[model samples]
Target: MSFRAPHDGELLKSEYALRGFLPKADPLTAFPCGSPYAPLDEIGRDLPSLLYDKGFRSYARGLRLPPWQTRVSVETLPLLRLYYVRIGFLASAYVNQVGEEPVETLPGNIAAPLIDVAQRLRRPPILSYDGYALYNWKRFRKDGPIALGNIDTIQNFVHMYDERWFILVHVEIESIAAEILAAIANVKRKLAQDANADLNRELWRIEGAVRRQVETLKRIPEHMDPKLYYKTFRPYIRFFDGVAYEGADTAPMQFRGETGAQSSIMPMLVAFMKIAHRRSILTDHLDDMRAYMPAEHRTLIKEVAALPDIGAPAYREVFNAILDAMASFRRVHYGWAEDYINRRTDDPRGTGGTPYMRWLQQLLTETEARRL
Candidate 1:
């Protein structure tokens, strides 16, 4: 299937449905008023540059709450709202100032509402130890002297939040997807193992469809330049910053965190491939193994258990296929990197900042070598 934009509401609903957690789809009569929660734009605006670069906006998109669960998410919404606010405030404060300051003191008054909202929502407040703060803050502070003056504060904020938030969001979404996929797969396995062959066929069909959707998601585009967006709002789009002193032959390059909701899908892709492979191998020989299998079969089961974690040969082939699919999907959907390289004169300094550039380069190089 061609890549198309995902409906966030629908995605969330599917997620909840798959998990058997269908939430009430009641209309939110009125959104809570005068709450400490900040507007989405405000949170976006206030995010640190480094964090922004890593693709917090993309991460939010990946959050795609099901429409039916919006009311249910109300409990977590305030917390979600506050979490971004704290990120925004910290981004604004730290960006405007050049030095490292305590997270508690950085935002001063603005932080009050954020803290209050977090408490009310039971969401943890953004802190120095959180992945966002730990990875990028020190580097941002160290590089304070040379960043672009107009966007220094924003850059630092985006970078700091990008890595920490990307990891957190990626892990959560992938974990949820993996659980649902595994459950569906398990049901199919049990049905196949049973004497009721008709029921097994029905379950297998449902499992197949779910598997296709999961594969479709792996091909979805998650990375894009924010500048290409139609809206006036521009959050951090670049995943890195390049600094070239007047006489230096090569610019210093720093990796910012990923951007966009789809970027978080990578871990899910990896997990799904692992699960799918194990399921395939297990179900393929399950009937045979049940009757005359030796004690060595126990070792095989143990080996399969370790595949997803340690990436055994079977899992490796499955993962490679998935990666190949992703690469082909990207090239077909977004055009090859040769176009980009030609346009940018193969300048790493400029293209390196783009999240998609690295992947594009890799794909193009592989394609070229094969032709040669």
Candidate 2:
């Protein structure tokens, strides 16, 4: 609930904390039909009901969707993301929604804008964590805190509280990441100045931030029933396997779903905490998740990761605590994935389109192994 971005301006990635990786502006609720891309926002608003209607695909085809001019710029980046995320939801729902067959080709009206907006952002034209959590929420009050209690998801695949709670929980956790990022930034500054004594304290702060994230992550079951999550809403966010954009590209274009792996927070922590995982399929997939993150967030991980090791014998214990905290976080994630996804289906693949059961266990095991 508290905004923990560094008090000092020099401390963290500005994009990570500024108005919460969530857009500072309230996203437009509707675009006029005059806009070439009105369906993204307009039909997107009514998507839940339309999804259930057997005629949904035909209805989408009925709309007149124009190709994007691609006149996007960094200044209106949030707007483009707004358009991108909405269209992404539409495409996912059209393909994965219950009544429809899992269609292999994404419609051009949807594909065109999705690809155009995504090209501008330099990320895959799919619903990623940036679209799913970071750009998917709005606050109840104009001046309220950007926390779970005050915010709600802007677009949803279904009209369920479980869906709302599921997304907002990530929003709250992303807010908590500010504290962790501040700690990482201070550690970087201390490392640069050869201040080993002060580094331990900052490392402890990082451990504390990881603990806070675990607490929020643990609250997933309180409002969101795992059954509803798995059966109803989860399908819309799964990997785009063998699916091609109707007009954008004819080849089968695949991208990971809007999973937590795409979140910049944990990757930044992984790089900053120095918890080295042995190379494996899971590590490669983790590395691949970076491509789904915002470009600056990707750069931030690189910047933190490029720092030389702490190298001080005294800081090893604190660093070990940080590793243990990270392992604990992964353990909680692994447990829920088992309870929620693994038990429900035969498919070993998670939303990230990886063998998640093995992958998560591997992650937890690797982090524990790095302990001093």
| Overall lDDT per candidate, in order of appearance | 0.32, 0.77
lDDT (10s digit) by residue, model 2, range 20-124: 344546555555568766656767778887887888888876766655654667665666777877877887887787755688888887788788778788998
- C-alpha lDDT of residue 302 in model 1: 36
Q: Candidate 1: misplaced stretches above 4 Å? A: 1-31, 38-74, 85-235, 239-255, 260-262, 274-324, 333-372
Per-model TM-score, in order, reads 0.35, 0.90
lDDT of 2 at 45: 74
Worst 10 residues of 2 by lDDT: 1-10
Clashes of each: 28, 0
Count backbone clashes in candidate 2: 0
lDDT for position 298 in model 1 = 29
lDDT, model 1, position 372: 9
